[model samples]
Target: MKSKLLLSWWNDLRLKNKLMILYFVAVFIPIALTNTIFYTMTANYVRTEKIKDLKLSLEGNKDNFRKTIDSIISFSTVIYTDGSLVGALDHTYGSEAEVLTAYSEVLNPSINRFVPMNKQFYNAYLYTDNTTLIHSGMLNFIDRETEQQDWYRATVAPSRSRKWMIYTHSQPDPSYISVIRELDFYKLYSTYRKILKIDILPEYLQNTLFDQTFPGKLYLLNPQGDIVYSSEENLPQRLSDTVQQDMTVIFSVFDGVDYLQGWQIAGVYPNSVIERSLLDSRKFIVYLTLANFIFPSLLILGFTRSLSKRLGLLFKGIRWVQNQRFDLLKTERANDEIGQLTEEFNKMTTRIDGLIHDVYIAELNRRQAQFNALQSQINPHYLYNTLDAVRMSCVTKGEEETAHMIKLLGRGFRRSLSWEQDMIPLQEELEFVMDYLEIQQFRYGQRLLHNLEVDERVLDIPIPKMSILPLVENACIHGIEHLECQGTITVLAVQSGTEAHIQVQDNGIGIEPNRLVQLLGSLESSRSMESYADGKHVGLKNVHARLKWHFADDFKLSITSDHSMGTTVEIKIPVSLQSSDDDIEGGIHAC
Candidate 1:
């Protein structure tokens, strides 16, 4: 009972609204729930552990850096106070060769041979104020060039003696870190104090810091907070300005006291990188939970869309049927129940279309047979009058034109009985009209004048039988038949584009505008001959209905007139070589 109620409620909602609800329940709820749980469990714990790790990492780097600096100091001390190396710088030679030999043998050997405990030092230099000493790789004269340098000036200042300083080394390798100290052991101030410089490689400095994958940057800075060395080239010069405002910075002084006077290490942890790492660590759980429902959600969406699309198509087909259209549904057939229903719908429409066709043909034949019977009765009555007129003409004129009148009557009767085909050639229809006119001419001599002006090209096209005859009859009986003077009837046939036009023009009494409007209005109001009143606009309405029935709505009959001038009845029908076979009944043709 609960399941049925749930189904009833779901069915009551629209398809798109139902899909939206399903997505929110199946996809969004699980995602939001997983994220909330994951964040609650790990958010603070991850941040605290990460900051602690950064501080510990920076402390370790500081300790190793201090040890490396101490080794440079220890090596510098041995070279600073060497008695033999000092004597070589102090000795003055009379010849350049003597100076070169003494320094190369003593000064160069002392500084070069003394190896430090740490392998980080790559090279060493001694800057002396001896004018006669040559500038070899190890020993160089402290001339005006050395005095102008900041390192030289800082080292030679009286207040900075016996203290170590760090600076970037440019020679041999720019990646080198240099440790400098001034020599203050000599009592003679004039001899000029020497500065000792030791170069350390970048590889040794990098080993003391964390790897590149670390979420923060590590650097060694002096007491002034200027970066002396960094683990990576991309490291920010100032942590406070370069890092985010919420970023964590861990700093500590060096553990080795003598080696690094005020040098320290700093680690910068940007909040963005930390949060990203924390999210990455929690991705497996969140995705695993979401993965379980993704396929099912997609399936639901697909089913909803399919059902809506099929129903939409079915509704469209029903609307078309309401408009009397029976075109078959032309969509792809699916494998589900809707597909079966669609097939059944197409079959039903086909069956209904066939039934409508059979019924329409039956009704059309019944109307045609009824019209023919009426026409036959009129012909016999007209025949009796023509014979009587002939007999009267014989008695008065002594049979002078009896044979001619009888021949015209014979032709009219023969054509009237030739209604086996509902459609005949335009030429034959014109011939039949001429025969009738000739008979009428004998009765009212010199009062009725009729002429046929038909284009030869339109003579061969098929038209509904007796289609043009009614228009001629209407022109004769309503128009010329009531005239006081000589009445003229003109029949004109021509082909205009895809249509054939046959017009009957009379020069006699015409209809009044108001009455003419009523006559044309009747034609417009009812196109079916069965609705027309007997003997009232029967010829005009019959011509309109027959043409309309045969050619659907593509045919037209128009009547135009002037008050007492004349009347023109024009009929337009589709030009065709042969009539449609669908109108044939049991090997006989019907319109």
Candidate 2:
């Protein structure tokens, strides 16, 4: 055998593994060295660093913008704190007036001028709790949820000391901030407190960082996620777009509210400025990286001349396999390790070729014997043929009971050989078993009971025919056949996604756990079993083998039992491996 193997191995066209491994490394390594491990990684690093630097500069600009905006708020607060303006502004809170009379004596002309200087600051409204707009530089106020929050409402509510807070308008803008001042009107009016509000716009926020030095806009966001100030000429546009939308940041203290609110100010540097800054650095680093990577990889490739030659020969051998020429590998390489491997491979193929022929013959003989044994092993065929003749004679003599038994047997046989197929639609297969159960019921009377539960949706699904019946028959004969009292069989078919599963259960004596393990072992180990009388569970073993033949590991068969609760045999077939809905009826197509 060893001499014949070596001789056969000499002629095979397959390449040995050592050459293929070298070929794979040659093809994959240089590409990764140039693109992934070297060039792309460096580019990614440079881009990340550029973005980080730009973000830091933007933060610096934003702080300056916020301080400048705070200047306007501080200035307004000073005027409101003064003895004269405070009295007039304070009276508006908690009063039910639509507009409070600003006595000409108490009016500071400069303070009035401050409210109209910018478009963002133009519309200021002060509201008292009793539905009064005591001060207005804008339009009419509407009745709506004030978007008041716990901390915000508390700050602006009338109190003994001072309450100061601000919120933006319901409408959004990047260049405006709304300021609210709480009033102490509850003592004077004895009913409620009111809030004093003002809108501050973009120009008031123009500080050193918001000046011409920065590349992008600066912004202030109010507690309600509304943009109230920006340094951009297109401030409103940027606020409406992604930049402001992305900045509705929730701080660490966002547990109680949907979102926490306050005045959040920001400055954005234009993307073009930073991108231009990186161009020369980008070019210098890119060239240096390519220089570092390409030269070394090229040198390595040049030095590995033997590896390249071996791979080229291996490629030629693969091309031969692709064309299905499994014979006679002609090579210039002498009998080194590659030649020895090639010799061993050729012998492996010749052995498989011979084994395939022998296995096919063995399978044919087994099927022939299986057919012969199945026929001769059961005495019911002779009993059925004689019973039918006697039943016809009884029918001629006008005995109805004998005629009924003959009819039931006829129906059983008709369904058993339906289309002479091994598999049929699940609906039809159940009908076949139910027909046989009728014959048994006639013989044994009400002592035999059967329950079948099947999902209606799975009716047209195809399954292995006669497969379910053998288990039920085994339950009836091998299990409960001794009991003269009562016995039950339950056949269940359930559909789970792509699997069409069938279960046959009977309330009879079940096999012990150890014996069941052995039974399963015999079915799984090999296809060739000696005989049906192998003291194993023959019918179940056959079903397991057929399922394996059709679906391989994609199919599943399991049995679970109780000595009192009977045995359940279940089959699972994967959806992807199933045949087409049209072809599933008549043929078993295994891919």
Poorest 10 consecutive residues of model 2 by lDDT?
A: 250-259
lDDT of 1 by residue, 208-291 (tens): 555766667777777666665675565444555565687777778765475466767788777776677588657865676667
Top candidate (lDDT): 1
Give TM-scores for every candidate, taking all chains together and pairing residue i with residue i.
0.47, 0.38
TM-score, cand. 1: 0.47
State the displacement of the C-alpha of residue 575, model 2, in Å, after optimal TM-score superposition. 5.2
Q: lDDT, candidate 1, residue 337? A: 86
Give the candidate number with the greatest TM-score: 1
Which digits, one per residue and each the tens of the lDDT, describe model 2 over residues 329-356?
5556458776665555556545555676
TM-score of candidate 2 on Cα atoms, chains taken together: 0.38
Q: Give Cα distance to truth, residue 390, candidate 1, Å.
A: 14
Q: Clashes in model 1: which pairs?
A: none
Which regions of candidate 2 are displaced past 4 Å? Answer: 1-345, 348-395, 410-420, 497-501, 509-535, 554-556, 575-577, 580-591
